[model samples]
Structures are given as C-alpha cells and as structure tokens.
Target: ISIIYISSNHIAAASEQLSTTSQQVSQGASEQASSSEEISASMEQMVANIQNNTESAKQAEAIAFKSVEGIRKGYDSTTYALNSMKKIAEKVSIIGDIAFQTNILALNAAVEAARAGEHGKGFAVVAAEVRKLAERSRLAAEEIDRITHDGVKIADEAGRLLSEIVPEIEKTARLVQEIAAASMEQNAGADQINSAIQQLNQITQQNVAASEEMASGAEELNSQAQQLIDIVSFFNIGERETLKTLSNLRNDTRKIAQKTTTPNTEFWKSKRTKSKPKPAEGIDIKLSSNSDDTNYERF
Candidate 1:
C-alpha cells in the first residue's frame, strides 16, 4: 500500500509537470503561429512592392525605348538638315561668284561708254546704273552666303551633339532594360519567399493545434492522476482505520483478559486462606506427626 501510495504520488507529480510543460508548449506554439502569420503578411507586402517595382521598371524600359527611337529620328533629321544647309551654302557661294562677274562686266561697259563722246552720254548713264545694280546684288549674295555658312556650322554642331546623345540614350535604354529584368527576378524571388513563409505559417498553425491537443491530453492525464490520488487517499484512510481498529481490538482483548483473570486470582487467594489451619492463641502447639517435620510450616 505504501508502494502504491508512493507510485501514485510520483505519477501525479509527473502528470502535473507534464501538464504545465504542455501548457507552456501550447502557448509557445500559439505565439509562434502569430509571429509566423505576421511574417507571412509582411512577406506578402514585400512581394507586392516588388511586383510594383517590377512594373515600374518595365514602364521605365518602355519609356527608354521610346526615347531611343525619338533620339534616333532626331539624329537622322539633323543629319539631313545639315546636308541641306551645306547645299544651300554652296548655292549661295555660286550666286556670289556670279554677282561679282556681273559687276566687273558692268564696270568695263561703263568705261567704254565714257570713251564715246556726247552720243555715248546716255549709254554711260545706263552702264552706271547697271554697275550699281550688280554691286547691290554682289553685296546681297555675300550676306546670304555668310548667313548660310553660319547656318551650316550651327547645323553641323547640332548634328555632332545629336550623334553623341544617341549613343548615350542607347546605353540608358539598355541599362533600363537590365533594371527591368532584375526587378522581375527580384519579384519572382520575393514571391517564392512569400510562399515559403506561408508554408511556414501553416506549419506553425499545425504546431499550435498539435500543442493544444497535447496540452489537453496532458490535462486529462493530470485529472486522472488527481482522481487516482483521491482514490489512493481513500485507500490510505481505510488502511489507517483498519490498523487503528485492529490495535483497539487488541487493546480491548488485553483489558478483558486482565479483568477476567483478576477475579480468578482473588478467588484462589480466598480458597487458600479458607484451607489454611487455624492456631490456638493460649496453648503451645507441637508438630511431631512425621520424623521429617521438626517444626511447624507456614501455609
């Protein structure tokens, strides 16, 4: 019985400990589940941001492509305009040469008219007017040539700048495309991480459920152990009562035996006293009934 009691106590203690540990585990699992859910939510948000970044990168790439196209077209147009300016400048130079030749011819004609006399007076006035017109034309042609040359120079410089810009724009477009590709890859990675996190969250939820089950089982075990302890306590009380009753019975039997034997001892003493010989008070008594008896013996 003592062994049983000790065993019950140990089992109860172990059950209580197990219940406590199980409760702790359940609580921890619940916390972990909550944390995992939060992490999963954060991962989802990160994935969304990554996706947005990917889309933005794609849009930037498209804009870069469009810019490259526009730059290319502008460069081509500038080249064409530069060529046109060169042609215009050449034509203006030719016009200036023609004007100079006309002025020289007009001057010679004027000198020849002056050599003629009064009949050449009218011709001399006409030659002077022609020379003046030729001089004006030459001046105007020179001015036009100068303006065309300046225009050509400006066009050439613009074309050169456009040529430089086109390559840089192309480089920018390429870089933007790479950025878009990287963003897409990063977005994909984020999605995968989010998925993993979701799976982890699910596992954590399972753990929480399992832990709760374990805790419940532990609690049930603890309750059973408590009932067993109660049963053991009842048995212990019964065993103690049995021992006490046996001790009391033994004591009562001993007392009864003592009470019953005490009267027997007194009755035997009275019988011996009644059987004892009485002695006369004034006579001297001598006992010689047997040779071995020399003196009277006390009963």
Candidate 2:
C-alpha cells in the first residue's frame, strides 16, 4: 500500500508536468498554424501578382516587337525616299546644265543672224525670241535645283535619324523579351514557393492535430492520476511520516508494548501474588512498571 501510494504520488506529479508541457505544445502549435496560414495567404497573393506581372511583361514584349517592326518599315521608307530625292536633285542639275547650253546656242545663232544682214532678219527675230525663252528656262531650272537640293538634305537627315533609331528600337525589343522571360521564370518560382508554403501549412496543421492529441492524452493522464489519488484516499494512511532509524522503531515498539502489555502483566502479577503468602502488617508489596524488566520468569 505504501508503494502504491508513492507510485500514485509520482504519477500525479508527472501527469501535472505532462499537462503543462502539453498545453505549451498545443499553444505553440496553434501559433504555428496561424503563422503558416498567414504565410500561405501572402504567398498566394505574391503568386497572383507574379502571374499578372508575367502577363504584363508579355504584352509589353509584343508592343515592343510591333514598335521595332514599325521603326524598321519607317527606316526603309526613309532610305527609299532619300535615294529618290537624291535622284531628283541630280535630274534638276542636269536640267539646269541643258538650259545653260541652250542659252549659249541661242546667243550664237543670233550672232549668225546679224552676220547674214537682209537675208537673216527673220532668222534674227526668231533667234532673239529663242534666247529670251532659254534664259527664262535656265532661271527656273536653277530655282528647281536649289529646292531639290534642299529636299535631298531634309530626306538625308530623316534617313540618318531613322537609321539611328532602328537599333535602339531593336534593343528595346530585346530588353522587353528578356523581361518577359524573366517574369515567366519568376512566376514559376512563385508557384514553387506557393507549393512549399502549402506544404508548410499542411505540416503545421499536422502539428496542431498532434498537439491536440497530446493534450487529450495529458487530460487522460491527469484523470488517471486523480483516480489513483481517490483509490489511495480510501486507505486513510493519514500523514506519511518517515521512521528513518532503528532507534525510533524501537521506541515506538516500546510504547505500544507499554499500552497493551499492562493487562497481561497484572494477571500474571495477581497469579504470582495469590500463590505466595501475603506480606504481614504495614509493609506494602509493589510491582515495578519498568517494561524492560525480563528478570522475572513467567508462571
């Protein structure tokens, strides 16, 4: 029974300790679950954002491609236009030369007409009119040549600007393509992260479940401890005092002997006295209460 009582006491103490530890574990599990849930939510949002950014990057890539194509077309047209303008300038220069030569020929013809005298008057009049027409043509050709040269300068500058812009637009398209690719990679990474977070949440939930089971086990242990205490309570062991020494045990034994041995001792004394002669007159015969006295033999 003492062993049972001690065991119960130990089990109760252990159960209390286990209950505290289980409560702590349960609380920690709940906190971990909450944190995991929060992290999962944040990961989902991040994955969604990554997906949106990937789409945006792809759209930007397409737009950049279109811009590059348009720029290339403009550059090509500018080149063609520039070449045509140069050809027009050349043609205008040729026209100016022809007009100048025509003017010189007309002057020579007029001189010949003057040399012919009466026979050349009509030819002279025609030659003077041709000279006037040639001079006007020369002036008009010079004006057209100047304008064409100006047009050619403007077209050449436009072509040079288009040529310079083409490479930059192509570079921009390449950069956009790279951005789109990187965004796709990032989106994939985000998906992996999201999956990891989900797994973490699952583990956290498992931990929570385990913690709850531990808590229930702790409660059962506590109940067992209480039942042990109740079962031991029936014995009325009172206080659990320690003896610790043989001397103390002897003392307790002597005390119990004194309380219980007196009746037997009195009966023995009466028997011995009755068998013996009575003391005479005023002399009294008294028995010693010294419990350790073993000198007298039993009757």
Candidate 3:
C-alpha cells in the first residue's frame, strides 16, 4: 500500500511536469514555425529580386553584343578606307613619276635645241615652258600623295583602335552573360531552399499540435494516478480469501475526491497565449458512469 501510494504520487508529479514541458515544447514549436514562415517569405522576395537582376544582366549583355557588332562593322570600314587611301597614294606617286619623266624629256629637248643654234632657239622657249609645267604638275602630285599617305595613317589608326574596342566589348558581354547565368542559378537554389523551409514549417506546426495533445494526455494520466492513490488504502495482509478479493479489485478506482481534484475548465489555456487548443483527439479518458451501487456485492 505504501509502495502504491509512493509510485502514484511520483507518477502524478511527473505527469504534471510532463504537461508543463509539453506546453513549452508546443509554444517553442509554434514560434519556430512562425519564424520559418517569415524566412520563406523573405526568400521568395529575394528570388524575385534576383530574377529581375538576371533579366537586367541579359539586357546588358545583348546591348554589349550589339555594340561589338557595330564596332566590328566600323573597323572593317576603316580598314577599307585605309586600303583605298593607300591605293590613291600609290596612284599619285605614279603621276609624280610620270611628271618627272616628262620634265626630263623637256630638259633634253631644250639642250638639243640649244645645240641646233639659231634654228632651234624658238623651240628652246617652248621646251623651257613644258619643263616648268611638268615641274608644277610633279609638285601638285607630291602634295596629293602626302595627303593621301596621312589619310591612310589616320584610317589605319582608327582601325587599330576599333579592333581593340571590339575585344573589350566582347569580353564585357561574356562577363554579363556569366553574371546572368549565375543569378539564375542562385534563384533556383533559393527557390529550392524556400520549398524546403516551407516543408519544415509545416512539420513544425504538426509537432506543435502533437505536443499540445500530448500535454492533454499527460493531464488525464495525472488525474487517473491521483484517483488510483485514493483506493490504495483497501490493500491488506489478512486471510487468503480477503487478500484474494482485494487483489481481484486491485488498481480499480472510483471518481472519489472530487473536492481535491481541481477541475481545469480550460486545461490547455496559457496566460501568454490566448489561442484555444484543439481537443485531444484519440486520448480516451474514461470516467466512472453515474450509477448508485446499492449492494455490497459490487464492492
């Protein structure tokens, strides 16, 4: 009887402590669920922002590609212009050579006319004028050749600079493409993480609900333990028949000590939280049926 009383008392106290711990676990689970939900929302927003940034990077990459194409065309045009200027300079040099040949022929004619004396003196003046015209033509051709050469140099430099720019723009485009790809990958990773967090939050909520139900079960168990302590006094060490009868009635309890059992109208209610917990489903706490046992045979 003393052992039964001690075990019953310990069970009841442990049940109460279990109920308190379960409530704390439920509350902590609820907070964890709420926090998980908030983190999921924030992660969703971050994914959206990353999508926007990825789109922006794609646009920039496209623009860079266009710039590269445009520069490539310009470079080709500059190279063509440089080649054309070089050809023009060559033609001008040819014209200068022709003028020099004409001047040399005119000088030879003047010398021959001088050798012919009085008859060739009239042709001397014409030869001298021819030489002068040829010299002036050679000077004009030289000036044109110099201008064309300078133009060729400028065009070549432009082509070279444009070639440099093309590589740079192409490099920039590649970098932008890489950035866009990385952002998309990051968005995918974030989406997967957010999904996992959502699942975890759901599991946490279920755990919180289970913990609440467990607390209710522990509360009911505590009530039954206290009631079992009530009937322990009937245990005896007398005649075998009487002891057998008591053994047959072993551990059976009545709904006695109603005054001592403080009924919790809102058993799951907490001062910190106003939310009402759902009923403890699947935990059957059977109470003694209301009946007046008039005969001693029932005892």
User: Among these predicted structures, which one has the highest lDDT?
Assistant: 3
- Stretches of candidate 1 off by over 4 Å are 237-299
Please give each candidate's TM-score. Answer: 0.76, 0.73, 0.61
> Model 2, 124-192: lDDT tens per residue?
888888888888888888888788788878878887888888889889889888988988898898889
Each prediction's RMSD to truth: 23.2, 16.1, 15.6
Ranking under lDDT, best-scoring first?
A: 3, 2, 1
Better of 2 and 3 by lDDT: 3
Task: Return whichever of 1 and 2 wins on TM-score.
Answer: 1
lDDT by residue (85-137, candidate 1, tens digit) is 88887887888788888878888887888888777889888888888888888
In model 1, pairs of residues that clash are none
Weakest lDDT window of 10 consecutive positions for candidate 3: 251-260
What's model 2's lDDT at 19? Answer: 78
Write one digit per residue (lDDT tens) for candidate 3, span 154-177: 998899899889989999999999
- Candidate that would win on TM-score: 1
The lDDT for every candidate, in the order shown, is 0.76, 0.77, 0.81
Error of 1 at 101 (Å): 0.8
TM-score, cand. 1:
0.76
